[model samples]
Target chain A: MKTRIPVAVAFLSGFLMIVAFFGSGEWLSMLTNEALRYMTIVAGFSLLLGVVSITQVSWGVVRKRGEDWPYKIILLIALAAMTGFGVLQGITGGTVFEWLFDKIQKPMMATMFSVLAFYIASAAYRAFRARTVEASILLVTAIIVMIGRVPMGQYIYEDLPSVANWIMMFPNVAVQRGIIIGAALGAASMSLRIILGIERTYMGRG
Target chain B: MANQGNKGFFTRLQNVDRRVLFVLIFASVIVPLFFPLKLPVPVTPETREFFEAVEAIPDSSIVMLPFDFWPSTLAETEPMAVVGLRHLFRKNCYVVGLSNVGMGGPSIADRLLDSIGGEFGKTYGIDYVNLGYKANYQAVMLGMGERIEDIFPTDHRGTPLSEIPLMRRVPNYDSVSFIFVVSDNVAVDYWVGLVNSRFGVPMGAGVTAVMAPKSLSFVQANQLVGLMGGMKGCAEYENLLGYPARATRGMDSQSIIHLLIVLFIVMGNVGYFAAKRKAKVEG
Candidate 1:
């Protein structure tokens, strides 16, 4: 019954949206709009479920005193504090929520992202070797693109930027289009399968 | 003895301490910041097209700016957002800010809008409105085509859309003249596929460097009117505006780092080939 009901709902919704896309009736448009609204609302409520699931998992680890239990405790405390502040004072500027986000959260996130530059440097030094013809080609291309992206490349060679642009525009776009078309075809097939009740994996185990 | 020492040096180069690389990168980034190389930044075709797209918008036309990026990518994306908003306001466009990212996107947009809008003496609600973050971006985007208020009933601050003067005139995608999405994620895809393709609204995007290659296809296909790839792209836009800001200042550091990385790669390759030849001779 669960599988059947979900499949039926999915089919109806998908069919209606497709019909509305090609049709021009006001009622059809209204139906599509309502469906979209309901989908958004349902997606919003999923966040509540996520919070519940995480709290349960973290609390279980804390109660059992498992590995990294201390981290779990910290996570729970942070979650509670942020939620409480958000619910009470809101996340507007100058509030406790905003303060935490600005002072602690923002810098931490930026620092974490900034660390990628070091890692990229280290990775390139260790792994970017030329063992074969193809590897040599890739290595040369990478070096060119890296230099060509910066102003120093122009100082070194004026035509470097044009070559880099040509590579990005022609070869890059051609490959990307191929991948996009392939992926779109796959997505269409999957959507068809779900609509036709052939894909019941989303319903979970029986 | 000298030959053996040479072999050791080459072998060590193949596995140089990562900390050394890290420190070199750190110095490269920091030194440029203080010294200010002020390298000449040439605008790319894509960035020029992006600028033209904004310039083509009629004065005081309503435009949607979606901040679908997080704070982690603020270094690259924020400059794009700042330059984009400044240009739009300079042209007297009414800005409607929104986000597909529920986590930090709305807050970031709110902060940027407040700071930049204040600079231009633009009034909130009257000249601009932040519709804020909505869940299920795909659905929110599609629903917005029918009625924006249906997707976002209130601004990020919980004020009803009906109360906002700008929102009164901008009801749906039909009313919006253009959409400029600054995202660090694949939300740009949904913006192109669902919003632009269906609603026929012109769109542009600013994405992180990692995502730029994929986004270039959209620009080539004319799905996106323009695109800004990364910090470099942002710097180019700043240059075009004749208002060199944070991005332009950071380009020197970016250039230094790129050069350092290339040097490291070349050194590593040289070491590998040397080691290979040495082993062959010994064997």
Candidate 2:
């Protein structure tokens, strides 16, 4: 019955969504919105399941006094602090929570992102070469683009801008076109699998 | 005859070290950047088309800006976002901001919008409302298409979207001049397939250069109105705004870095051929 209900919901919801596009009625729109609302509710349940699994793993590792036990304790402390503040703010609409969100959370997000700057250089420094034909082409193109992109580079050398422009407008466009075609083919295959019910993996294993 | 050896091309290919390649690629990117090179740009007909479309909208259009890119691509995307919102505000466009991803987005978006929109005397909630994070990506897109209030019952605060003066009478996409996506990993195709086709509204994308190549098809198919690519696109838009912003500054670093990479590539190829000739002579 549970399986039947889902399969039925899937078939009906999927069909109606397509209809909602064509039908343009308030009832159909509301139905579409309700499906989204219900999906969010289900996602909440899924999240709860995830939180439980994560807590259990952390607790288990801490019990064993694993090498990373201190980090696990830190995680628990942060988890409690965030959850407490989140619930409290939701209940009271307080600014203390907003303060914590702005001061602490935003900085943390920025710091994580800033780490990528270092990593991009480190990765690029190791990869760009001209040992092979393809590698040579990429190296040349990358150079042209890097030079072409910078104002100072153009100032130092007059022709750099023209070269950069050529690389991006011509070769860059060609490569981008290839990616678009490849991605289109992929999106089609995945959508087809879902429509045919062959991609039941999205629903999880029985 | 030297090429006839059993340990030929494939042998050399198999033993290449990625680290050395990294250094060459590094040099290839950086040298040109320091050298100062500015290429002539002929704005593509499609990008021009998008700019005209935005211009065609009424003086005080209600526009939806979706902050979909995370902090990962923030460096590349933020310029377009800041500039686009600036232009929107300049035109007296009512802003409705939403994030299809994380909770962190609204605060950053809200603060940036307030600072920029403040210049044009735009107020929060009335002129611009940050709808905050909506869970379930595809579903949210569909929900917002019909009734945004249903998807977001309240503004980021406890206030309802429908209760807001600007949102009170607006009916779906008709009221939304366009949905502008300043995104990195979220491709233009997703916008076209998920949002544009779903809602039948105009969509625009500001994408990173690496991702720009893949996005041309949406432009080709007329699914997207405007396609802004990377820091250069940001610089061009900055020029359009009559202001030099982060993208303009970043262009210095970007240009130099690209040159450094190219030089390294040439050096590596030169070194490789020289090494091959030396080995042949020794043999």
Off-target runs (Cα >4 Å) in candidate 2 are: A1-3, A22-27, A90-105, A152-185, A203-206, B1-52
iRMSD values, candidates in order: 0.9, 5.2
After superposition on all CA atoms, what RMSD does each candidate show versus the true structure? 1.9, 5.8
What is the overall TM-score of model 2 with all chains considered together?
A: 0.82
Residues B113-200 of candidate 1 have per-residue lDDT tens digits of 9999999999999998888887899899889999999988999989999988889998898899999999999899999999888999
**What local lDDT score does residue A41 receive in model 2, on the 0 to 100 scale?**
67
Evaluate residue B243 in candidate 1 and report its C-alpha lDDT on the 0 to 100 scale.
86
Query: What does the lDDT read for residue A25 in candidate 2?
Result: 73
Residue A28 of model 2 has an lDDT of 78
DockQ of 1: 0.83
Candidate 2, residues B1-283, lDDT tens digits: the string is 3543555453444334556555654564466456644443334444456666766778788888887766556677788889888878878888888776565566567667778888778888678878777677777777777777777788766677777887785656667878778877763556678789866789778888777766656766678887778777777667655766777666655554555544444544555566687688879
Pairs of residues at least 3 apart in sequence or in different chains that clash in candidate 1: none
Least lDDT summed over 10 consecutive residues: which range in candidate 2 chain A? A89-98
